[model samples]
Target: MRDRIDEEITFRKLEVLLAFMETGNLSKAAEALNVSTVSVHRALHSLEQGVRCALFRHEGRNLKSTEAAQMLADVAQEVLALMSDGIRATRDAAGYSSDRLRIGSLYSLTINTVPGIVVDLKVRRPALQVELALGSNAELLDKLKQGTVDAALMAVPETEPEVDALPLFEDDIFFAAPANSPYAKLEAVDLRDCRDETFVSLGEGFVTYHGFVEAFRVADFTPNVTMKVGDIFSLMNLVSGGVGYTLLPGRVRGVFGDKVQFIPLRPQYLMRQTIGVSFLRARERDPNLLALMAVCRLRTRSVG
Candidate 1:
């Protein structure tokens, strides 16, 4: 009957109309929305102006909704619900899906750290489907920036401007050797003591690889690195088979089993891996990420 609903009519105006209609009082509607009563009055006025319709009748100090206002209030609830669902769907398509979580982690964490976190996350969000990715530290960071993964669990000290890190726990680095190796009998081994010993190390881009290099640097000599491998387990296996010794996270000792021994480094040369979750700062507010971070915080607190 009247002109078509104006383009200026917005979802917020619809919300204000619905709140006022349901409450039947401006003050009540304002209380619900945590806004001033005057603000609620202004929103209703704005809605009327935008739609070019009288949605309410002023009766003394109280406001009464007209027939048309009652009808619009009922429709506004449905419209708001539909708009919310549409926004959620759009976000899911843009990679912030709540139904599923895309996660990245280091190969070293697959044994213990990753599993514990995954199990805890599933327990907290039972309906959430988890997609796991494993890679070297650099590779996982790259995947995070590219949005190929929503969050990553990796060794920390990450300084990428776009990345937000939450350190879970600290893990000591140690020299891994065959259980039968002579050095296994000692409480600690200085990096210089193994100067002539052949070393099997993780390749560049892996966090342990950098730590290995720094340990040697502190010792003032280069290691006789015989092989540069990709995975920590492979490097450990090589060490256990008497191929060569390798430096690794002590937390993985349980994974490598009794075949390998983890010897702590001298205090001054000690390098600890700060294992944690890393994600884009932009994704910090994403529902899926917020849920994952909550689980991580609880788990880390229990461990600490």
Candidate 2:
């Protein structure tokens, strides 16, 4: 029984059978399989012997498939498809390239940094598919740690021993206000002078929010934050519409055009956020992550 099972129709034989059924002739099947006509004939003959059935009948110089051949051809299609799916699943489970890269980033990085990195990564790996997930700094970090995302672009965390980071650039936080506001005209503004200002800010867990809290702490008072938002763009929209003032990274300067103004903070309250790519240290050798790190290094050099 084991010998019979081993000698039963093989995938290669089934491929030849399917090719013959598809093209309807030995010569055509040989052309499709990139083999000689004699090889196609031998494979089909071997398949018939293994199955102990007549899969084809010679009609002079032409051959016609039997009803059995048609049934086997249909099953061959399904078998091949399942095999292909299994191979892809196995590769993905083993951390091999599944031809898709999942990337996480802060909403603000979508304005500039993420776009450039994605474009460069595609240039390096033309067939790689990139999936981008946008969220706050803490949210992206969580996704990276959970392995829901392969890598993340955000403010590098202070302590993550199990993670590897590639610093791309440093961005300073600026005081953001409506274009028509009095603060827009200043060369720089002291955080202390804004003590009486009503403010809108990003909710907790965002790196910018932490910076906001520390900057105000240096000014010796807690900011009167009247509202909190989840994303940077909405916070900017509120600032533009005169809803209230907020802080933003310099990377987002031109995104709002003249609708909003970003003023430098006084030296005592200055804070710079280090933006970079973060991934699991275990995946440091992953080709996709390596490509991302290279792109970031190029970006850093270009910025410098």
Candidate 3:
């Protein structure tokens, strides 16, 4: 019996089996389950095959359950009810209520955007508990896909079928240099003008790194990057200490106080980053994700 049960029975088959018994018609069962009639027929056939028994009697365009099928349906009802109760209890024990949200963001946003978003989310859901993860663009997106984080705030991801993103604001990329540096005086600097300048850059995996590569490619010169730091704050410190210049989004302008200058690149370079919230398309219907998206929409106008 154990071997037969292992081969033929499954929770999904049990659900279809019970639904078929309750409706007593394949089409009605399909409607109740919100599935196609063909799907209900296939599931019933598969269930019979797994149990290695004839569980239904064919009656001219209708499927009628046998005594064995009726007994299985009764057992299925109790099992499904108990399983539902178990799931609810488990969720309660794990503190995984709908009010909890797992959010991810780029480290740069911690300076402004994240703080304000958290405050807004708390206002809307007074009992909400937020778990925040701050990392590079690559890391945040990976976590979203893996389901470790529910939502992310970062540069708009490149085209991917699995990801769903909502664009919040556009941030122009700007050249950052020490306040006393010669490049700091320029209203706008041509990328080619900085060809010989030593530069500090955020390491690979960061969105800014890719933007820098594109900007330099357009300028048709590889920058002499002297340092590759992991975080924007450290990169900003390197530039402010006169080690080298770097590029960053306009949103981070307030971080450096008066130590660094932010000069927009010439329009010809076309360097800009669009900030957005990203999540797996599969998680789109999640209640916590919906709440975070609401906050994102409300805060969109406030972002520069």
lDDT of each: 0.87, 0.89, 0.86
Off by over 4 Å in 2: 1-91
Candidate 3 per-residue lDDT over residues 25-80, each given as its tens digit: 88888899999999899888888887778999888877889998987788889999
Worst 10 residues of 1 by lDDT: 155-164
TM-score, each model? 0.80, 0.70, 0.75
Candidate 1 lands at a TM-score of 0.80
Decide which is better by TM-score, 1 or 2. Answer: 1
Model 1 over residues 59-94: C-alpha lDDT tens digits? 999999999888888888999999999988888886
lDDT score, candidate 2, position 185:
80
Report model 3's TM-score to 2 decimal places. Answer: 0.75
lDDT, residue 146, model 3: 78
Where does the lowest 10-residue lDDT sum fall in candidate 3?
90-99
